[model samples]
Target: MSAQLPEITFDEYLNEQLINSLNLQTNVIQNLAQYSRHISFQLVDIKNDVEILANRVIALHQQQQSQFLPPLQMFVQPSIPPSNSLCFFPPAMQVFPPLHKPFFSTTPDLPNKPVPFSFSTIEP
Candidate 1:
């Protein structure tokens, strides 16, 4: 046997539609709130990771300074004309400064001899 459907008035039909629309709006707002909370949590985690990496870099820099190691500094050769008075090192050798002599020449054979490092200007 088929179930008989009840006939509703026009006003009741409009009310039902309004209620359904409100329910959909509520669901959208809840979903948006959940998404916002998830994004905030991820941002906090990223912030903490960046802070930890920054601290590690600072510690590494301190250790390098205490051991008389070369602090990472960019060595740029001036674009002036090459002369005997000017010292111009290539890009490969420019990274290490002459101050790191002891750490570099720690070999047994060269115990007494100091390694010669010259940054002579290239003739162009």
Candidate 2:
């Protein structure tokens, strides 16, 4: 003899489905939250490392500038003009044209004759 199964009502079925859906959504939200927290921690670490690197770069730049550059007083001091100096300025700059011919001019010219071409109708 075959055993008969009890009929499930539509309302009970719907409630069960809703619960499953809510459970799935809750798990997804929790996973996303955990992932976001992980990313945020990484970002925080990267920020701190970047800040330290930037500080080091600034210190190195300052040290190099101090080693290479002249004293600040020399730039600040005003120089006296010589009595024999002429108010003459240098001549204006001149622009020279390109030495070689353009690509289009270098290429051989096309023939004067019209190109022969025929269009055939495609049959279905």
Candidate 3:
């Protein structure tokens, strides 16, 4: 059997907490969404801080890239890679050989014949 639940006492602070608790949550979603009154304010502060940090990082990245890297040359062509570059292959090379003309069974093709065995071979 279910136990009887205790009644909640009315309080000025509790009423204000309940009211603000509902505001801290969003109702657009069907499922319950809730956050502490403190967390709500902290999240706003964090969002502002993140925006400021993102702006500073972007500005610093731009400044650093401009200062440390060479300027773009419109007529420059990238140096061609040396012709003697060596390449490596994985071990699956055991099962496969590079470009050998694929040959199937060595046996030549034969034309089809009718059924070789008959059921009338044995007597009843």
Candidate 4:
């Protein structure tokens, strides 16, 4: 059997409408918060992947530069110009000084004077 209840007044109806509006607004705010959290998580994952890719790209660029760079070349023989050859006088003037032979030779021209040498000091 249905029980008789008192009719809701105009003030109570207005209050009920206000409460429903407030509940709907709260539900909307909660849904927006959940969506923002989901977006943040996705952004975090994307950031990590980007960082890894950036590091890999840097390593690859370094490797490429190393491979393309040329090694320092060293010459086996020293390449000296003809003018750099050692001489007592300048060749452009072409002046020849009188040659004086050394007083001593392999035959020992100063045998009587006796050339002082370390050979005499070295004991056999």
**Candidate with maximal lDDT:** 1
Top-TM-score candidate index: 2
TM-score for each model: 0.50, 0.56, 0.31, 0.50
- Sorting all predicted structures by TM-score, with the top scorer first, yields 2, 4, 1, 3
lDDT for each residue of candidate 3 in 1-124, tens digit (9 for 90 to 100): 9999877667866997988888666453323333465678898788777666755654554454456456333343344455675653333432433232213344232223222222234367
Cα lDDT tens digits for candidate 2, 96-119: 343433334543432333222212
* Candidate 2, run of 10 with poorest lDDT: 113-122
Residue 117 lDDT in candidate 4 = 39
Instruction: Please identify which of the two predictions, 3 or 4, would achieve the higher lDDT against the true structure.
Output: 4
The regions of model 3 sitting more than 4 angstroms off are 1-35, 69-124
Per-model CA lDDT versus the true structure: 0.62, 0.58, 0.50, 0.59
What digit string (tens of lDDT, one per residue) describes model 4 on residues 46-106? 8777666755654554454445446323333333346756653434344443233332243
Q: How does model 3 score by TM-score?
A: 0.31
The residue pairs found clashing in candidate 4 are none
- Single out the weakest 10-residue window by summed lDDT for candidate 3: 109-118
Compared with the true structure, model 1 gives a TM-score of 0.50
Error of 3 at 74 (Å): 14
